[model samples]
Target: MSLEVTVVQACLRSGRGGSRTAVVEDGDLSDAARRTVPGAVGASQAVFIAAQDPAAVRLRFFTSTGELPACGHGTVAALAVLAQRSGNDRYDGVLHSTTRSLPGHAIGNAGHYSAAFEPGPIDLRAATIEEADPILSALRVSAEVAGCHVASVGRPRLLVELADRQTLANLAPDMPTLQAVTDRLDLLGCYVYVTPSSDGHTVARMFAPSIGVPEDIANANSTACAAAHLSTRGHSKLQVDMGDSLGQPATMTATVTGSPGTPIVEVGGTATISGRHHLD
Candidate 1:
């Protein structure tokens, strides 16, 4: 059997660079089959739309390594494709996945789409020196770190804050060592970022070799983790800039509401349907 896959680039910067994700609208595919789509299409992740209705849409996410409980960019890409196919400029519904269900909305305009959704629960905590030392060694960085914490927006990511953008840009992690550290810590990936600029924009990058992603062009869930970490420090809204190292520059917006220790985070970004693929 052959499956048609729609390629979408989410979290684009000026309609140019973003993460390329494959979206497949098939309900009958097994977990094993879904895992093959990403590798076959040269994409890091694939989203399967198992079912849809006027009120809700069910989605499943996968990487070449295995299935994921949730995915931020994949969710945005899937919602954009669904809105376009429905011939509507706007779509409002719930996104159901194996791990959680989130209220989501998408807007399509002039061949571009913006999608946002509430992620799962938020958890943030400071990291001990023992936890931080191994990761820092793997990253091969001795620069002064401003803050170190473990954060989660359904998925756990080690959020490391550097003193300046220069330090953040100079990162060259040992992928093998970093992967081992993530596995030991039971983390999804490591998110290294600089402090927010005066205008409330942050620059960052993500690495998750344990999940077969050596470097992510744009990581929405990690962005949410950053938002949650900063919200505790009195930041309510901010934009995250990522993907520059690999040349696929991307931007994602994160809004934090409610209060500290229990903040609500919403992640969103624009995406375009770049092309398609046929998976056998």
Candidate 2:
């Protein structure tokens, strides 16, 4: 048996550069096969597109660690590939993860594709200065920053505010302690950010020790959660600059609609096909 896969880098030059390789498979990919394929291709995540439909196609994502409940970048990459391969200028698809089903849409041609999706619930809970002090201390960040809060979409991520973009960029997180905090709180990881200029662009860095991704290049879902948090505080739409710590930085923009309590968050970004491979 043989499987064909297309590799894609999502969020392009913005945020932390990341890729999702979509495996063109006919039937369900076994758990072991799912783990083996991505690892063999040297990709952090993989999306398997099966049973295609013009209205919506079935898609699933996996990582070296295990099957993910949902993946924002993975969805974008899958939809982009679908559009490119099918020669459709636009497409609507359903990305079925292990735990949730998300609707995805994409527009573009060939190597350039823009994709968007409605993420799951986003809730922002205020975290007091005292509550976040310990974590900041662990990360060598100060507690004086104003916008510290915890944001939860499908997963919980600590959104910490810093004094400036430079500080956020210079971060060197203590992975051991950071991992402990994420595990204790059952969080996916922490997203540290700051608004340096008057342009209102929020620069950020995502760290997830729980999943062994010390620093995620570009994290779409978490960035959407940040957008929702900012919307609750009066900012509706903004560019989220992430993954600057890594040389291959990427940028993404997110928008939030409706009231703060029930905001609809959408994350949009471009994806480029990086490579293609086959496995048997």
> What does the lDDT read for residue 87 in candidate 2?
80
lDDT comparing candidate 1 with the true structure: 0.88
Q: Rate the local accuracy (lDDT) of all candidates.
A: 0.88, 0.74
Which parts of model 2 are misplaced by more than 4 Å?
Answer: 14-26, 53-56, 128-134, 196-198
TM-scores for all predictions: 0.96, 0.88
Among all candidates shown, the one with the greatest TM-score:
1
**Candidate 2: worst 10 consecutive residues by lDDT?**
14-23
What TM-score does candidate 2 reach?
0.88
**What does the lDDT read for residue 111 in candidate 1?**
52
